[model samples]
Target: MGWRTVLVNTHSKLSYKNNHLVFQTGIQTEMIHLSEIDSIILETTNISITSMLIKRLVDEKINLVFCDDKALPLANLMPFYGRYNNSLELKKQIDWAQEKKEEVWLEVLRQKLINQSRLLFKREKDDQGKRIEEFSCQIERNDPTNREAHAARLYFNTLFGLSFSRQEETDINAGLNYGYSLLLSIFAREIVLNGCRTELGLMHHSQLNNFNLASDLMEPFRVLVDEIVLENQEEKFKQIKKAILALVQNTYPYKGHLNST
Candidate 1:
């Protein structure tokens, strides 16, 4: 797999040249070997990509994220199918029983709460961490009691003080939303590659959103960005953005294998 997350922030015309992705801006042009790029982030509205290059990127299973005029990610390019029997896999995904889906979602919530508890422990809030751990252990199938919400209320208040609100428009909230959006895109790509629809979720069932599954899968990983924000709470938006992007390279041990999450 490729390792580079290519960011195209400047106005450029992208095309396919030989085996490289050619970028032209004004009088200058540059070539990036396509094999070395894991993903491409079109961070500017002024960028244009050739159809040929787009096809090649899809063939290579390279993730492509597109940002809006305000430089916030809004969409991503996912292929119609995965590398294997995508139709069969999707059928199986659609046929998943509600009982099994609920069971899986119960585990997802359990892990998310566990991670939140660990984050609290790391921040020296042992009492709060124990409470969260208790909540994690008490989670029923599909979180029927909504302990996740109760835990989130305590988690945010204990960590960010009583005044902190994720709903308010603040630099901390902006940084966190941006980082979680990027993480959601990553999870969306993985779901598509596994022949599952991002619109279908294990627990999340927002009718208006297309990335419900991504949101569900990204719950446990959210603590990573939370840690980043805690470490650089006073930093401005730009630095936080760069720090979040840099986190793509960090690997985690999962199921006897290393994962770039």
Candidate 2:
């Protein structure tokens, strides 16, 4: 897989040339070999890309994310056939046992809750953190009682303020939404790269959602975004966005070794 994430923020024209991605702007032109790009984020609507480049991106399994006018991720382009055994993987996904799915979902929720509580504790909100940790233990299979939602309410309220609601129009909400979208796109890319369907989810079953599995898998990573947003509340959205994007480079202990997302 490619290792670089190229972000197109200004007006530019993108095209495929000589096995490279040609980026042309009013002042200069640059070329990056296709093999070096893991993904491309178009943060401006003023850019134009050729169909040839689009085809090359798909063929190389490079993700392409499009952002809205406000510079928030809106949609992404994913490959239809990600691997040679994609049909087999699809059949396996379709045949996943309900009990197994529920079990996996429960584990995912528990990890997410643990991460949230840890963050709260780090911020010195011990009481709320303990409450969230307790909720993790109480979570049932498939989260029938919705302990996740309850914990989220308490967690967000404590972290921001009692008056805070995720639906409200605020800078915090904007940062969180943007960070989550970036995480979702990364997870979706990995899912498709492994020949799994992004629509089949363990817990998130929204009919309108195209990336349900990505949503489900990204739960544990949400707190990372929250931590960055909380620390950089005074910074502009662009700076916060840079920090969130750089999260992929941060190393963490996983399964007895260090790993990066």
Candidate 3:
């Protein structure tokens, strides 16, 4: 009923048929319809999208997301679905996101906490609780940028099993930051579609905190990030493509029924 978000992995085949994005599965190929899709997400070490396809996607107003080795959305293709400032529904969605900002923001925070705790437990029940506490405090701070900055620090520390410096702001890989930014925007768009305010954020700008709701809401889905990262760190990414496909195709209950939509 909204937008379709598709995730493809390393060296995966992507051909658009009408409004479909297709890939090979074993001997059979699977397809995701573009008209039914809100966004297309790709993540992997060796990502190669054809020029012709990319142009077509742009012209069609379909959002195309590129993810990095870390499986963070690196780039996105934005939709031109509205005319200038005359888009009434877009404005209403924006207004609604701002209206229900508090509840949405808090929900994001609580989910983030729960996800982080689950991650730690999954790794080792006796891991460092102190680190989790610190990460939680940083994420809950009144600045979304601060949350990302600090969260990246904590995340990398746990990720690479080493201490990280606050002074570093390196991209996960070359040309990858672009994709992650787009994916982040896609997530924000999803929040807006869910009838939550993308602005009036809980931990974002005081002047105009648009997309903070998106920032808050992406907590549970952060596992998608972790799953991508894990695959990249593997000796050989045999499962990287499979993992991405699984993530995008996986379903669960949201408002009432079980679905990834």
Candidate 1 similarity to native, TM-score: 0.94
lDDT of 1 by residue, 1-261 (tens): 688888899989999988899999998999989899888889889998999999999988888999988777899898888648788878887898999989888888899999999999988999999999999999898567989999999998887788999999877787888888888988998998988888888878899999998998898999888888777778887777777786676887788999775
Candidate 3 lDDT over 177-250, as tens digits, reads: 33235436757655544444455454464554445545555556665556455446452333444444454446
Full-model lDDT for every candidate: 0.87, 0.91, 0.55
**For residue 133, what is the lDDT in candidate 3?**
47
TM-score each candidate. Answer: 0.94, 0.94, 0.52
Q: Tell me the spans in candidate 1 whose CA falls farther than 4 Å from its real position.
A: 255-257
Worst 10 residues of 3 by lDDT: 171-180
| Model 3, total clashes | 15
Candidate 2: misplaced stretches above 4 Å? none
lDDT of 2 by residue, 1-261 (tens): 677889999999999998899999999999999998887999999999999999999998888999999999999999898899999999999899999999999999999999999999999999999999999999998778989999999999998889999988878888899989988998998999889999999988899999999999999999989998998877878888887776665667888998766
Q: State the lDDT at 149 in candidate 2.
A: 94
